[model samples]
Target: MEPLLLGAVIVAAGGFAFLNGFHDVSNSVAAAVRTRALAPTVAVLLAALFALLGALLGTSLAVFFVGAARGLPPGTNGLAILLTAVVAASGWNVLTWYRGTPSSSTHALLGGIVGAGIASRLTSGPAMEGAPEGFLLRLILPLLLAPVIAYLLAYLAVFPATWLLRHASPARVNRGNRMAQAVLTGVFALGQGLQDGQRTTAVILLALIGTGSADGVGIPMWVQVFAALLLAAGSLFGGWRITHTLGHRLVHIDPMRGSTAQGVGSAMLLVSGIVLHLPLSGTQVMASAIVGAGANQPFASVRRPRVVRVLLVWLGTVPATALLGAVLFLALSPLLQS
Candidate 1:
């Protein structure tokens, strides 16, 4: 029974990573794909490889998830709660992907775990207590603020990026920026993998810890490899609608602007994941960067309505996923407890 449950948990965790590849992964490479800086096949493949490398970069995000996992009550109740969170988060990921909305997988997962924690406290008393305490300071606030930071950084980067090539010809700048976009997009994809890849790996590790199959403290290397590969597979076959929405609708005038957004997004992800040890949303960062890149030109050049829709979608993700997680936990608690 324990082994089966462990397998189930690992599968659920992989599903989330797979969904992330198609949905959130699209954001990491959208600019490069849209601007023709890299072919779609090449871009996705590049993202997949780089994402794998990024997964191995460090495990801070994985450790964070483990902290959340530790808060879960041990035994069947804990397993059920963790499973429910994965299902709910994955469901949200599928829904958002079908709608072509660039929502945050991080937000969905957070909602899931938090919702599960709240539900567990109600269902089983003190076992689940204090589990959700550190999240606000560690995860939620940083997630909420990351997009704003990405927008500002990307927006600020545009003028300087453009200024550096002020003396260059349009053709020259375009070609050069295309090359730069390809490279930066690859780096961004790696960062995306680093931030998100460790996340699912953490979930799997938490499950192992909960089940007494492994120590709760460390994320095994095999788990990291598996998560990275699954995520990359998801990216390779990602939905193009998401790519289209972010690339064309938001901003993709040329390679230069696209490069500006992607470059900023990558830099932010690197800092957030590696330096600050935050599992910030790559989707949020990319989306905001695109808007910021658009701001480099006249306001009319940007699609205000579309941007509004995207922002609203991002804002709605947490609440929706949280509710889903809470509801699923309540519904399943009675069944799984016995």
Candidate 2:
């Protein structure tokens, strides 16, 4: 990788991290605001704090994602591969944000990796590589199962919660849920940082090793810190559109449903990304959890049209990003070669 190309790739990765912060804010803290449990400013601030913490606390996800990058053909241009992936992922993220859709940053990156990897194989003769079968299976299967797990987990949590609080007065239930919302929102925010922040770290790491700045596979502490800080800074603004969609448009979020939905989504991210080692999307999980939470409400129909639209966006993220990545790589092939 050329120095100029490497530096350009790093700038693109940083932009992606910045977008990730803002793009995922609603996913982390919308429930708190929606339930009136936390002010929007407080919610975002807390989200920022915990996101930075989560990014600093874990390196496993970063390691795993870097390994995924390694799965691309061995002799392919690493700078080109990373640039293509970053460009596609960021482009998709911006489009989705403008449309007020909470699409998956993780999926966008993965799709870009897959697409660019394919493109490399086509253009680089035998040196560029394909993804390892084990890696692909691990990546794709968990991604497929994530929404279902989120829905079921959220439904199970909310249904039983409502039933448990049935004997309480409405006011008492609301108060309790509000308290829960405060705690869960922070937890979800932390997990978002842990899970999503590491992704940006992976890209940066790829750029470093590919461009010959780093000596080995080990990620520097500064990289983790930089990724964390960038993510938190990103969270400081520009998430209101998705916030509205999740907090108000998906369903009428009461205190209990808001807390429960966030809790379920947070737990799903912890289990899938941290425990099971799957880099699933916080946005998709939260969206599915919101629907599940709505279903548990007394006679709510779950807003089928909104649900359908969100689902469509989730389903389209990978393919759309993959196609975009492929085109980008092809378009820039000459520059990449130079």
Q: Model 1 scores what on Cα lDDT?
A: 0.83
Tens digit of per-residue lDDT, candidate 2, span 171-213: 9999999998888888998888889889988888877876568
Best by lDDT: 1
RMSD of each: 1.8, 1.8
| Location of the lowest summed lDDT over 10 successive residues in candidate 2 | 68-77
Model 1, 1-338: lDDT tens digits are 55666787789999888888878778877898888889988888888888878877888888886775566777667776778888989999888778888888888887787787788777854356565767647777788888998888878888888789999999999999999988997899889989999889888887888788878656688999889888888888877888888988876467888998888899889988889887789999899888888777755678888889888888787788778888988997766655
Q: Residue 46's C-alpha lDDT in candidate 2?
A: 89
Candidate 2 versus the native: TM-score?
Answer: 0.94
**Model 1, C-alpha of 95: deviation from truth (Å):** 0.8
| lDDT of every model, 2 decimals | 0.83, 0.82
Error of 1 at 115 (Å): 1.7
Q: Model 1, poorest ten-residue lDDT window? A: 124-133
Query: Residue 278 CA error for candidate 1 (Å)?
Result: 1.4
